[model samples]
Target: MAKISINLATGSLQQEEIIVGIDLGTTNSLVAYINPEKNPQVINDMGRGILVPSIVHFNEKGDALVGNEAKEFLTTDPENTIFSVKRLLGRSYNDVAAHQDTFSYKVIDDDKESLVKIKAGNRFYTPIELSAEILKELKSRAEHSLKTPVNRAVITVPAYFNDSQRQATRDAGKLAGLDVLRIVNEPTAASLAYGIGLDPSEHKTIAVYDLGGGTFDVSILAIQNGIFEVLATNGNTFLGGDDFDRAIVHYWIESNKLKEAELQANPGLMQQLRLKAEEAKIALTTQNIYNEKLGDIWCSITRITFQELIKVRVQETLDSCKQALKDAKLKTTAIDEVVLVGGSTRTPYVKQQVADFFGRQPHDQINPDEVVALGAAIQADILAGNRSDILLLDVTPLSLGIETMGGLMDVIIPRNAKIPTKAGRQYTTSIDGQVNMKISIFQGERDLVKENRKLAEFDLKGIPAMPAGFPKVDINFLLNADGILTVQAVELRSGVKQEIEITPAYGLTDDVVEKMLVDSITYAKSDVAQRMLIEAKSEGEQLVYTVERFISKNGQVLDEEETKITLVHIEALKAALQDGDKDLILKKADDLNEFTRPFAERLMDLAVSKAMKGKSVD
Candidate 1:
């Protein structure tokens, strides 16, 4: 008898493998799996406990440390110990600029279009890389606990995470030596932890209100026949238990008449107070009063005063719940279940307020911190074809794309997109009288096609000759239920067309595919660094080209000093690109853009005014 395989993400045939579930959190991370007993269990990593602090520290010799070992550096080595990195994922300088100072470590302030990076030791690390470090720790824990080579997983992220953030999470998993099959939403996973969608004939509408250490989001889901669909989600990524701790910190500071500068000057004192506040938060959950001091720093608060200080934050969450309900077109009474998730849900006041608002006690029999991971394990089981009660729609594992000019990867169907899906984007020629347009298809997360796996290529011939950026070319990707990909390109003006069918994994053995997956994780850091460098260099080169062209075309519009300053900054950016530092290149790029933005806007206004003169409304 021959054995058949299954592709966990797409439901296509492939080699079977054990799939783990991961919850890559801001303050802590963990891994879980459906064990031999057919129960989802969190990996303890030889009695180290479940919650692995989402922290990384560098030693005197620059050796990276993760989890509990890194936790000790929070106060001693605040500059090199990074925590709560999830808030920085897929974010730019402008995204978190207002609160950048809150971080104990340095966050690079550069181009708003570029993703944020942090400075730790001699190197710069993006949030994706920092997050991958945490995931790597979790992966090791799972492998040690299972005593097997754990290579595949289903990871959970916040429902409100945008495409970039979701992709970043997937990339982090890849970097952590795991083939991320699916990126399940945290709220959906929380619901699954309680077996809310076990019965195929059942129907329910529920709200998952998750307030974790660093983020909060409330999702309204409708479950019918084991299918969970999110109706609405709303919350603050910057709001959570961390804010509650800060409330205590600030209260103590005010009561003691301590200046903000004094607290800021003593890193050890701040970290101690923060830890004390955390202890106090947990203590008040079971006790009415928390009175303690950390190295002369008082951390004392009554349960009522603690509640009073964070009452506004809790109300903000309630307002978000109301907004989510309103958007879902459902009332509080219509919600059948209110699921509380995340470690912060242990707070009695938070629980009571939610109960009061919904007029029902929240469902939290399962541990809030582990709920998402447990749910993810259930999702993995479904993917493994272990659950006949639930049906899963087909999906694509990696994004499918084609190579564009400057070696950029232009995506057609992003990863995790439902199969039998068709999405197209219009393109245009970059040069005058351009004829043939080559379509090179590839798949993976990197921004450049060179870093991804190339499937095939074809050319759309007989395009009507036209000026640059004028020819309308429509490129479409149609993926079938079997995972076969068909790419088509057509010229709307001339009706010239070309198409190709690509079997994404054609002729690739299971070991080869597995090797590729492992290779992606092994070279993850260098690949991401290379990709960022390429992106910065590409943008800088393009800007330099545009500035040169603009000077050639409209040099008369600028003063000598303006022209000189612009040219000098352009040269500086060009030099920074060769410095081989992605952050520096991006910084210079931002500087140049800022210097020219006002003058460019002024020039545009003048041209528009000149064109609008004597023009009247029809």
Candidate 2:
């Protein structure tokens, strides 16, 4: 055998290829790469254009449909369509199962795998599997668009995603056969995006208000000399555009005298209403009022009306923003510029709210949807050793700690501490004859262990038995550049190292991720396709069912021609569903919904009447 040669410097035997950056989101995903000229650019796939909707549809043929194609099937196959997989990444089944009602997909319980299974036709899938499909689709798009086989990438996650969720996101990338070099926070990535066009000498404090499809994040940063430091950050993992859509849907149902259960049962109608609501929200940005005709349902909404409806939700965002600024020890006036990130910020009402809160107009120069991805690409370039001039110093979003006496949390690393930082704490045996000491680590702002999120727990073993308070254990916690924590323990007297295994309290383990990947690949083809067919069939059934029910309940409210047109569109949708054609199913669904414009209007009127009567009664 030839002698092996090892190079210790740089920890590489040979030069590595350049890396890319990916934004794997709840509602959409995008891939960007640094070109040879050193500029970052997003790679657009042929079929799906630029941004891929983070929706996966398992069709009848067991094929997985991703992006817009999959989103189109959500209404028809609500049971099999999986969106917002990001929320489930690295999370336990129990953690996400409680919020199943918030999603449009069917989440089945799987005790054996400790996974949340998504039901699609005859098959079931774990959250990791669904996320892997989206990741794979993104990988394919990046490779095809770049015309090169890309291997290395930097992926972004929510700042508030627990250690388990972060690990899950990394596992998804691994399952998709991509090497994730680092996992950056979404808001930090947005800051990087803004830094690209900005002057480093500005040395100003910037606030990023990022409200995306399924999450909201607010981060305050201080920039100077090409150094970007995240001072503080806060967000709700379960809040975003989805919530706004739900808020509007609630308003419509109450205004039209529609039953909540009826809306829930009819996925097609829900889709229609969500789509209309989203349109109205966008329209309110530039126009004061807009009219929507959904089949026999016709309704008009003004900007003021939309503002009043979402005022509470908007206020919540403001509150979080204020809290983030407070945590950073800065006031609104201290912020030099407020950059808005995320698609949901396109709403004029949201812009106005942000402006009023900050006492200044929000910046809208950059594309909200693309900014985060662009920033991620820049970070990828830095990791690829292409941009040594720039450096990013991000902070921990939550405090890391352990449980102490009285169930109180003893904080180790306080939140907002700079990354690649280390802290050590010394502990002594509490009882006589103690041979092992367990350290439970928690992350969150809460003072109690039960209130905060438990990040991990590890035991330091192989300790000599000692009298009470005699044994000394030194524990060191280090957060790396990726924001993941690592711990080490050393016995003071013996100078011996103890085994330390971190068990995340809320995140999935590596073993679980591997199993999920295997399962997803095993049923990748047929399960996805079958799930799609089921969704299409379901949408068709729902549209026809809702239309029929509406006609039966309010037939006298519509004229003869209006009734005939509505019936014709319903028949068309029913026929399309029978033939199992997705395109036809969608077209007819839209047409029939349009024909019922008058009925929809009457329904809103009835809902308003009921609300007014309830108020009087109260």
Candidate 3:
């Protein structure tokens, strides 16, 4: 009877859900939607909460595991598990080659293309495919949680990510079978989450300092009633918690006399060490010392010592902050409140440094880890026309230009310039009877071509082969709201247009991504066990090297009881290594590290006291 009289306009079926926002990060990824109540809620996958670790693991059954489950296997099955795939997105083999030693994955050179090949059992897969697997998981999560098909989304990226990187991110979204409406910068997304609204007078200027798991970004924004405009943004794509982990790992190795060769042989050892180092860094935020038994390694690390080792990195974040302020032409005092986003900001030392720099305490009102995703959701609402009172106008983080006559970079769009902007330059033939014009695009603030990040290269053919400077070619560079570059060239004399189909020199191509998926699925079964063995061997080596170094360097200073404890840990680790039980080796490593806690604390206190004396000069 109700069906006969029901009006569709008054029923639940009458309304449709709009768009959603996604933060596709290096360490983690999340999706959120704006509900009918105008509240942003994170969508969970299969009853799990928000905040999915951006990781993927290929199991022996040819099934792919993503999120937290995948991250758990990172050290245990490193060869089959891939994390931090975001860093390699849109990057060339050469761009990531020098830093291959830093990542856990194996990078293979395929002619000119650099491929991230994950070895599992008897098979290997590329980075792009692995990334797609993660994306697919995310898509499924959103669809299952919302109980509605998620066809469109607004994904956020690093402000400093170049055109190629941006394109790669878009490709990933496409592979996941979702329509990517727009690619917003991470920092700008955070500002939207703040809900400054479009009142220019209320918040004239604001700064977003984002230190995420694998990257750091600083963005200066100016809000005019409902318009959140990004004035300038800059950051190190490779700097963040990951760097801090490496710094501490370096300290652990040097202090314990860990040999480089041993670490090379046992890759899993480094992963374990990195995990411990991260824990120590986090613990130091609230306590004076971090004490724990890592597997078999007994270690006590002091906050003061950890701070000393990471001070330079902390300073670097501040430097980026200052530069952002300078770019906005605003003083530190002009900033009403400094908004800190990202898990790294949880560090007390980092918070204190930011306070001292701005002469004010940073706002901790928002959840550091969830703020970016929240902001992205807010932007999604605005883009879907669900929220009209908010507008986000973000800028390009780096300067966009082309190479000039002397191998110099000529800026067409200066860094920090407003978005949806276009600029054009005219070029003439270099030599007599020149047939075509060559254009090289770069993204950076450097005056020299080599100093900037090369984006793409294209040739404008079909020139009339005119004498030296007769033919005129108009080159135009267009930067969209998402900060991607679209270039075009027109031969003025013949009204003929020639343009280059720009592909990122560093990121994955569409064909490559498809190939990776097939390979990952094919080799999933055999790779799991082999990957574990390799990782375990690596962890064992790291433990042995660290203990040997610690004993050699601090032996003379240890008392009888301390020496006995140290010896016990060392002997345990050594015994485990001999047996080739990766788990046991790790357990012993933790015990040894714990035994040296007291000594590490004492050394840190002394070092801090000495350093403060130098810093206190008026």
Q: Could you tell me the lDDT of residue 167 within candidate 3?
A: 53
| lDDT of candidate model 3 versus the reference | 0.69
List per-prediction Cα lDDT, in the order shown. 0.83, 0.70, 0.69
TM-score of each: 0.80, 0.63, 0.61
> 25-71 in candidate 2: lDDT tens per residue?
87888888777787778877775577899999888877999989888
Clashes of 2: 47
TM-score of model 2 (CA atoms): 0.63
lDDT of 3 at 589: 52
- Candidate 3's displacement at residue 502, Å, is 21
Give the higher-lDDT candidate: 1 or 2: 1
- Report the error of model 1 at residue 601, Å: 9.8
Worst 10 residues of 2 by lDDT: 4-13
Per-candidate Cα RMSD to the true structure, in Å, reads 5.4, 17.4, 18.5
Ten residues in sequence with the least summed lDDT for candidate 3: 5-14
Model 3 C-alpha lDDT per residue in residues 326-439, reported as the tens digit of each score? 888889888775788899999888888988998988776788888878888887776555655544456444457898765656667654345767888677774657777778
Indicate the TM-score of model 1: 0.80
lDDT of 2 at 233: 88
